[model samples]
Target: DEMAQIREFIEIAGEYGLAYEYINCALERHPYKISGKAAIKLLEVGLLMGFKSGRENDKRFDRR
Candidate 1:
């Protein structure tokens, strides 16, 4: 069920979207400067977890 929803979302939104906007404003308010890898791990955006591999055992959805 969850996988189906994710596929539908990707089909609709594609692989790109408003990834930046007022990002500087957000950074200005925040003290920590996160790396690209670290940012993907953040669950608020869920970019990492949101993408799942066919194998449920693999948490990062890495392709083998």
Candidate 2:
């Protein structure tokens, strides 16, 4: 039932401006296998890194 429940979790995450990411782990196999939780963590890490980098560049912008 995990597949059925994933959508529910994804929607909940979206409400908080977050995303549920999915990655293909079995590309060599006939049918690709998806890594669900791992994808989520990867996305979260990427987003955090992007935000941190952006903050470091904040000095380049001038409101006035």
Candidate 3:
């Protein structure tokens, strides 16, 4: 079931021309830590693929 959902999410991201690497990375690193709402927001903003670590990535997502 979880795998199905992940596939579905990848398809949805593909529809938006979003890459799957970040999602796959997040899944690999923190499979059960992601929240549905956060995922949706990330997708909505086209930031799902921009997910990264460290200070630079953090600054990129920070709101002014």
Candidate 4:
């Protein structure tokens, strides 16, 4: 499910995937030139998505 969500997200928002891959490469090679805000925003959105999904899963588990 997580993979599916990630795949859907990548398909729906290709820009974010591009940004992530670019940043991943850039950080490994040269870590100083990346825009901090853009990286932070990306991480924030990712964390939010994970949190929301975890909460939903928790609810489902609790309902059992």
Candidate 5:
């Protein structure tokens, strides 16, 4: 079932440091060998951390 979902091409995002934070969090938490909601939380923490970092850097970046 999961494989079936990935066949549709999954996408992820984070703040300015997405790749670094995301991979580090996944590796630190051993997100592999797991599935579903718990896995989502592990990844969510990383993204939120990255978002926080970016937010701290520039509080008004909405001009875009």
Candidate 6:
């Protein structure tokens, strides 16, 4: 299910063109320091793209 969501996100990103390219560049540039603001931005993007947080009634994917 998680993999399917990821694939869907990728497809959405592809449809958005340069948006995903910027995201990929950001990710690549911050491979080791993906915390704080960068992390929040990524999460915001994923949520905006309709990717589930997998936190609802599913502790498996919860942060804590």
Q: Which candidate has the highest TM-score of all?
A: 6
Report the lDDT tens digits of candidate 2 across residue range 1-64.
4344455556655422222222221233346454888667765775664422223344454232
TM-score of 2: 0.27
For each candidate, give its TM-score against the true structure.
0.23, 0.27, 0.27, 0.32, 0.28, 0.33
List, residue by residue over 1-64, the lDDT tens digit for candidate 3. Answer: 6555567666765533223444545576774677899778766655544543344546766444
Question: Per-model C-alpha lDDT, please?
Answer: 0.45, 0.42, 0.54, 0.53, 0.47, 0.53
Off by over 4 Å in 5: 1-32, 51-64
Worst 10 residues of 2 by lDDT: 17-26
* Between candidates 3 and 5, the lDDT winner: 3
Q: What is the lDDT of residue 21 in candidate 5?
A: 41
Clashing pairs in 3: none
Q: Please name the candidate that would achieve the greatest lDDT relative to the true structure.
A: 3
lDDT of 6 by residue, 6-32 (tens): 556567655442444345555556755
CA lDDT, candidate 5, residue 34: 60
User: What does the lDDT come to for candidate 4?
Assistant: 0.53
- lDDT (10s digit) by residue, model 1, range 1-64: 5335445545765542222212323454668688988666543353433533233565564543
| 1-64: candidate 4 lDDT, tens digit per residue | 4446555656787655444444444565664565889778866875554422224434653322
Write one digit per residue (lDDT tens) for candidate 5, span 1-64.
4333333333432233554344445555675676678668855864565433244445453233
Instruction: Tell how far residue 44 is off in model 2, in angstroms.
Output: 0.3
Task: For candidate 2, list the clashing residue pairs, or say none.
Answer: none
Q: Count the backbone clashes (under 3 Å) in each candidate.
A: 0, 0, 0, 0, 0, 0
Ranking by lDDT: 3, 6, 4, 5, 1, 2
Model 2 gets an lDDT of 0.42
Cα misplacement distance, residue 63 of candidate 2 (Å)? 16
